[model samples]
Target: MGLIVQKYGGTSVADAQRIQAVAHRIAQRYQQGDQLVVVVSAMGNTTDRLIQLAYQVSPEPEARELDLLLSTGEVVSCTLLAMALRAIGVPAVALTGAQAGIGTDARYGRARILRVDPSRILSHLREGKVAVVAGFQGITEEMDITTLGRGGSDTTAVALAAALKAQRCEIYTDVEGIYTADPRVVPEARKLERISYEEMLELASQGARVMHNRAVELGWVYKVPIYVASSFTEAPGTLICLQEGESMEQRNKVVGIAHDTDVGRITIRGVPDRPGIAAAIFTPLAEAGISVDTIVQNASVERLTDLTFTVAKADLRKAVEMVRHVAQEIGAKEVLWDDVMAKVSIVGSGMQSVPGYAATMFRALYQAGINIELITTSEIRITCLIDASRVEEAVRALHRAFQLEEG
Candidate 1:
């Protein structure tokens, strides 16, 4: 008589057969005496396709109307999934985010969760029915519908798990789990049995698209145990939880190497090393909603310094324009921008207070003849920007440097 929240991404229930298969899985779990709450995303590529259709119709889509159009993708998924469950003799009902009382702020596109009243969901649960709720979309305090940001469904699932006090939140995805290096980057990379929420957050922020940062942040805040497994393969996947003293925490000194290909670098060369220059340079990019990561300011001269910051490649053009304004405002000699940079990070909590770890990473990359454009370090991670084409090579070198080859 416990509650469990399971969220399946679009790929999991993309087709009719997959929906029926998911229904069977949920029914088996439901009949086993658990009050099951399911959160589902839109069908596979549905959201993307919708965006394409919208763009074809109109070049620039308004945010409010776009949310209204985008929110329908999840509705189709939830209802169909519910129907599949019912056909198999399972008492299941699909509810939109609003119908289930998932309330959020009126932020239009990327609204944050305000609260969730599970009265309707609980009613279905008490009546021996599985409550299936659409993920990502929510209702505002003013009773208007809003869509959560990208990967919002994962956030929705984690939020619901926390609200329901479910035993665990399972996030089924396309990959088996987090790996020592992206399997595509390093074919010999090994899957992690476990990773701390902190490391997971850093990884997600760095580049792991399997779990969203907002969802991981919620999980950390709520102390919710999260599992990421494959939807197609019945592989034993990864668990993300506390730092250590857990059954799955690894004994290795290094955890994983994360590489991102969609990162660009902007170097503000020869700026006067004034106190407010860094802030002045980054403020515009921040205001544009462009996330800046791994900033480095070259050692100052008598009064001159070069500062660099990382932003997503997709925002390269806008960020460049912002930097141009910042340069003119701050009196920088030159504004250098490169969209061909990739970021590679080595993340593990053990690295804190562990000497020479960063040195070892640098040596490995050096041995591979991969040029490092910029280096950034934290208490628990080391990140570097290199040529985009060498991203995979950098990851492989780091993975081997850490000896993460699978047995």
Candidate 2:
């Protein structure tokens, strides 16, 4: 029998009843003779609650100690899940990320997986035991505990799937599948039967929360087929993999729409458009670990240009402070920022080769009376910045414009 790696999100095992339900599902899979390795996130809002508690103790908890505290939530879930399985007469074992051989670099809050040994997992599978591993965390070379950033559990699951060479990796979450747009926003949205890795990565990075981009990238690198579905139901979900032999025409069509409302736009106006000016403005933010997104620079006039970019709204304060300091240092006229912004994106493969796609998107937003602030595009994706309040309207408008509901 082939091996399978299954990952359940926080909502899947939020309580005793939910935990028991997931355990029963895994027990059935084990009874069917598949060697199983299950990964689980902290139950429900456990991680968030832990973070809140940590901050209650200290306004700014040390990253290393915060990771040490956050890692306990997953351990609680994994152990409870193992107990649930054993209660139902199935043999199972719970292992922490370190015990399961997940090794990473020394970064505390957003550590990347360097390697996974899989020796302990192999031993459990050999002993006819189901391995229930904690997700979202690993140990550094120095043996310090580290937590991966948001959506890190998805990364943990895909990394394990690659290491074990599982037949398929299943990601269980709150949503039934990947939809053309956020179903809550676009009621007419349709779920995609399958999506290419490139398209999925773009969607994930753009704003789709069905899975993390890092996990999708890892799966693409290893050529692992990932299945996304709801843990509450058995309905068929979306499959993310290479679309072998798909025609060029088929690849050019828009596949999905993604939007992010947690965006802040900053404009550094009248800066000397000299060499390394961009570097000087951004390097400090990068050093501060503040990610900048959707950058646009206007044409230089008389050796001066306006540079605008977006960052996560949560990082707006720090980003503005750092940019203002840089602006003063570089003799820029002023720094301006707006926190009430959103980014709407459409993604597909080979979209750049197709004509009229960009025009269609802009026309739809314009017709809806949404003002576009900035625009950026990739070979397979196009993104527009607009008012946060109009994001839903813009998403629905673009969804109708692209005719994504037909499929």
* Best candidate (score: lDDT): 2
Q: Candidate 1, residues 1-407: lDDT per residue as tens digits?
A: 57989999998989999998888888888878888999999999999999899999999998778888989999999999999999989999999999988999887778889998888888898898988899999998777889998889999999999988889999988899988778886888889888889889888888878799899999999999999998788899999897666432343367777878888888888898878887887777776678788788888888888888888787888998888887888788988888888889998876867678889999999999999888887777888989999888888888888887853
Candidate 2 per-residue C-alpha lDDT over 273-385 given as tens digits, one digit per residue, 9 for 90 to 100: 99999999999999888888899999999999999998988899999999999999999999999999899999988888879999999999999999998899999999999
What candidate 2 gets wrong by more than 4 Å, as runs, is: none
Scored against the true structure, residue 10 in model 1 reaches a CA lDDT of 93
Q: Each model's TM-score, in the order given?
A: 0.94, 0.98
- The CA lDDT of each predicted structure is 0.86, 0.94
The TM-score leader among the candidates is 2
Model 2 gets an lDDT of 0.94
Question: Clashing residue pairs in candidate 2, if any?
Answer: none
In TM-score terms, candidate 2 sits at 0.98
**Candidate 2 weakest lDDT stretch, 10 residues:** 103-112
